[model samples]
Target: MSGNSSRRSPVERFFRMSLYVFAGLVLLQLSLALLAEIWPWLLGIGIIAGGISITVWWLRHRNTW
Candidate 1:
């Protein structure tokens, strides 16, 4: 009766895990909502940055082939 006194029951553990998952989802939703207005700008910057990086990488590696 005392071997696992600190361990939670299976049902309690399941509910705790579910609560954590629910909280994570809520936080994700809130963050996405907050970023909704800037999402397009962020995407555009990402695309431009990615293109520039790729071009630079290609220029540096082109002579290897």
Candidate 2:
């Protein structure tokens, strides 16, 4: 056999990228959640903005992937 590999489909690639983004966001949110205890207003705004951006991204890409 050969060692060559096939390229991933666009949808598969997009899904994998999304997974990575989701994981990073989860970590970021976790840290923000912890910091929120110290600065509730600032961290709360950051969290809300992050949530909105994530939701918009999902809505736009959901049909493509």
Candidate 3:
């Protein structure tokens, strides 16, 4: 009975799971708010990086095909 007593009940487990979900949602909302503020900069950098990557790949592989 000592081991069983140490284990959490279903209600306690459900509460813990709900708490985790709530915390994760709070964190996700905060991160999205921050991302919204910096999204344009991120989008610009992503586009430039992607363009450069494609250019480099084309230059290296253009003659292979």
Query: In TM-score terms, which candidate is top?
Result: 3
RMSD of 1: 3.8
Which residue pairs overlap in candidate 3's backbone? none
In model 1, which runs have C-alpha deviations exceeding 4 angstroms? 47-65
lDDT for each residue of candidate 2 in 1-65, tens digit (9 for 90 to 100): 45445767899999999999999999999998887777978778899999999999999999788
RMSD of each: 3.8, 17.7, 2.5
TM-score of candidate 1 on Cα atoms, chains taken together: 0.57
Give the per-residue lDDT digits (tens) of candidate 1, residues 21-42.
9999999999989899799999
Q: In model 2, what lDDT does residue 18 have?
A: 100
Ranking of predictions according to lDDT: 3, 1, 2
Lowest summed lDDT window (length 10), candidate 3: 1-10
Higher-lDDT candidate of 1 and 2: 1
- TM-score against truth, every candidate: 0.57, 0.45, 0.73
lDDT score, residue 31, model 3?
100
